[model samples]
Target: MSRFLFISCLCTLLLACQHSPKKNYFYLSPISEKTVTQTSSNVSSQLIGIGPVDIAEYLTSSQIIDNQSDNTLTMSDNAYWAEPLDKSIARVVSLNLTQLNNGRSFVNFPWRSDSKPHYSLRLHVDTLSRTGKNANINATWELIDNDAKKSILRRNFLRSIPAESGAKGLAYAYSQLLAELSKEMDEALNQNP
Candidate 1:
C-alpha cells in the first residue's frame, strides 16, 4: 500500500507540472544598432576604452531579479535573461556611447596590446534591479586619463525607469540608463578635453 501511494503521488505531481506555462526569456537592448568606427573629420577626439562592468553578484544570474524589499529578492524561473546580464549591459553601454558621438573613437576593452587610449571608462553597477512596475540602476563610473595619469570624472548616478510587462520593461529601463550615462560621459569628456 505504501509503495502504490508513493507512485501515485509522484505521477500526480508530474502531471501538474506538465500543465504549467512555458518559461519566457528576455534580452536587454539599448536604443539602436551602432558600430565603432574611425573619425572622418578633423575633430579632437580621445580614444575611449570601455570595459570591466562589475555587477552585483546577486544580479549576475540568468534569471531577472525582482526586489521584493530592501533586503529580499525574487528570481523568476519562468522569466530569465537570454544572455548574461553583465555582457549585455557592457555591449549596450559601448554601443550607446559609440552611436551618441560617432565622431569619437570608441573601443571595447581587450584591444590591441599596443593601443594606448587617451581615456578609459570603468563602471561599477550596484543596483540593476526591477520592482516590476519600475526599473532602476544605481552605479558609479570612473573616467581615467592615462596620458595624464589622473582621474577626470567619477560620478554616481541613480535613475528610475517607468516600466511594465515585466522583463521588457526592465530592458527598456536598462537601455535608458545607458543612454543617460553615455550622454553624460560624452559631455564630461568634452569638458576635460
Candidate 2:
C-alpha cells in the first residue's frame, strides 16, 4: 500500500513539473486581403445580407489536465486565446457574400433594406468547441433566407488537430474551419447558376 501511494505521488509531482504553462495566443488569419471572386450569374440589381448581428458570440472553455501529452503546437510555444474565433467566422462570411455578386453590402441585421435583395443570406453558427482529446473542433453552420426567414441550408464542420494547448490549437482549428466553411459556401452560392 505504501509503495503504491509513494509511486503515485511521485508520478504526479513529475507530471506537474514537466507540464510547464506556455505564453500561447492564436488568431484566425484572413486567407488574403483581396476579395473572393465569383462570376455573377444574375445581371439584375441585388441587395444582399451584410452583418452586425445580434447572434450570440463565440464561446470557449478549457479542460483541466488529463495526462502528460506533448504535441507540435505546444512544443513550439505556450498556449493562449487571441482575437475570438466567432468574429473570424463572421468576417469570413461577410467577405464571401461580398464576393458572391455585384450586390451592395451592409452590416445591419434582421436584414431589412430599402432596396430589396433577390435573395438574403444569414448565418447562425453554433458549437465551435475544441476538445482535449485529439484537439477536435466541431461546428454547426446554418444559412437562412432573410426574405423567407427560414433556414435554407444547415451543415456541420468537424476537424481534428493534434492536441496542443492555447493559441496554436485555436489557429490550426480555425484555419481548418474556415477552409471547410468557405468551400461549402462556394458550392451553395454557385449552385444557383
Candidate 3:
C-alpha cells in the first residue's frame, strides 16, 4: 500500500510539473471608425501596392519584445503574435489606408502579375520596441510611381506612444502609430496624385 501511494504521488507531481502556462496571442487593430468615416469620402481610382515591409532582426521573433532598458531587451514567453509582425504591420497599414481613402484600390505584395498598381509603397522599420511605459517606432517609407518609373516620395517617420501595461497594450499602441503613418501616407499620395 505504501509503495502504491508513493508512486501515485510522484506521478501526480510529475504531471503537475509538466503542465505549461497558457499563452496569449495578440494582433494589431485597424484605424478607428470615426477617422475612417471622416476620410472615407476621399476617392481615387488609382491602385496602390503595399508590400515588402522589412523589419529589424529582433522583431522577427513571434514573441512580443520589451525594452527593459536602452540596451536590454526582453521577449515575452507567454505572449505571442498571431501572425508575422512585418506582415501584420503591412496588413494594418493597408487596411487603414483603405479606410482613409475609400474608392482607392490597394493590394498587398505578390499581387497577380497582370494586376499591376500605379504606385508601390515600401517600408523599412529600423526600431519597433516597447519600454515599460511607452512604445516607439522608427521607420522609413518610399512611394514609387510605377508608371513613371521614378521615386515620388521618400520620408522617415518616428512616433512614441504611451502604452497601457502588458503586451496587449503595446500592440494597441503600435496599431495607433501605424494608423497615423497611414494617414500621413494618404496625404502625401493625394498631393502627388
lDDT of each: 0.76, 0.52, 0.86
Residues 47-144 of candidate 1 have per-residue lDDT tens digits of 78886678889888887875546678987658888888878877887777766666677677766768868788888899887765777889998998
**Model 1 spans with C-alpha error above 4 angstroms:** 1-21, 32-46
Cα RMSD (angstroms) for every candidate in the order listed: 4.1, 10.0, 3.1
Weakest 10 consecutive residues of candidate 2 by summed lDDT: 64-73
Model 3, residue 140: distance off in Å is 0.1
Model 3 scores worst on lDDT over the 10 consecutive residues at: 37-46
Worst 10 residues of 1 by lDDT: 33-42
Q: How accurate is candidate 2 locally (lDDT)?
A: 0.52
Displacement of the residue 163 alpha carbon in candidate 2, Å: 7.0
lDDT by residue (20-46, candidate 3, tens digit) is 788899999899877575454344466
Better of 1 and 2 by lDDT: 1
Q: Relative to the unseen true structure, what is the C-alpha lDDT of residue 189 in candidate 1, on a scale of 0 to 100? A: 64
Candidate 2 regions with alpha-carbon error over 4 angstroms:
1-25, 33-47, 50-84, 96-120, 132-135, 161-166
TM-score of each: 0.78, 0.53, 0.87
- Sorted by TM-score (best first), the order is 3, 1, 2
